[model samples]
Target: MARSFTPKVVTANRLIQGDTVWLTANGYWSSDICEAEFITDAGTAELRMIDTETQAHLVAGAYLADAVMGEKGPKPIHFREDFRTRGPSNYAHGKQAEKVEKNV
Candidate 1:
């Protein structure tokens, strides 16, 4: 039997800055995972993948990531995707840096 489709979110790295980004409902790429568009339909997910292809100038390695709807928005289903949302792990920069600054 075929596996049932799980909800997904479109993710990629910004081509120039290498920031992790997700496709939003408005068609813009957002660095925040919570702003990602959560797609539950297999067809819609495939269609979104196609849309990502057209945005090659802005992003790279575009693919669907399993996700679930959360109070804030889409939440990643795997450790890898969760790690991506935190930005670079190299000594606190990017999203990690901003978090540190905010807590100061």
Candidate 2:
């Protein structure tokens, strides 16, 4: 039997240092940092990756997912680059921005 596609969101660490990214959908990601764009359930959410110190927002991607249920809360998501660079990134969900600066 063919498997059904499960709805999912693509999220990544705000500070990713890599050339290419692999989102949930294979072959749908971008290598050019300038072309990065968030993929959400409602559709693509335009985003920019900003340098924490310089405050320069570079075009980037963001993803969405169903809010986590009871106790679990919203699960955190990370980019393929982040995973390869630093293993699985810590989950922050709503506070991802705040947590990004802190060491994992």
Candidate 3:
């Protein structure tokens, strides 16, 4: 069964350099160009990357569900198949993949 999109709010420690972030629900987060924005019945709500200190808005992309927060704020989410290839993956793919993999 296809899952319904739930409105969510999440935060990140920081967005990667030269990457865009988005407003998942209320807080801020970073996502790749392929996963940033979505057109909903409400309107076009984009995943906007911003500088933590400067508050500058970055580029937008598609929405990613795996990149969500847990009970703790800004907790990492494993959203891609590659990351999950070996058991319950803890790695966040893309730029964060290497660091996460090493730690795991």
Global lDDT for candidate 3? 0.33
Measured with C-alpha atoms, the lDDT of residue 62 in candidate 3 is: 26
Candidate numbers, best TM-score first, in rank order? 1, 3, 2
Q: Write the per-residue lDDT of candidate 3 for residues 65-87, one digit (tens) a residue.
A: 33343343332344442232222
Candidate 1 — worst ten consecutive residues by lDDT sum?
A: 95-104
TM-scores for candidates 1 onward, in order: 0.86, 0.23, 0.27
Q: Any runs in candidate 2 off by more than 4 Å, and if so which?
A: 1-10, 16-59, 76-104
Q: Which is superior by TM-score, 1 or 3?
A: 1
Q: Please list the residue runs of candidate 1 whose C-alpha ends up more than 4 Å from where it truly belongs after superposition.
A: 88-90, 99-104
Write down the lDDT of every candidate, Cα atoms only.
Answer: 0.84, 0.31, 0.33
Order of candidate numbers by lDDT, starting with the best: 1, 3, 2
- Pick the TM-score winner: 1
Quote the positional error of residue 4 for candidate 3 in Å: 4.1
Clash counts for the predictions, in order: 0, 3, 9
**Over the stretch 8-89, how does candidate 1's per-residue lDDT look in tens digits?**
9999988987778889888988888888889988989889998988899999999999999999999998998988888567
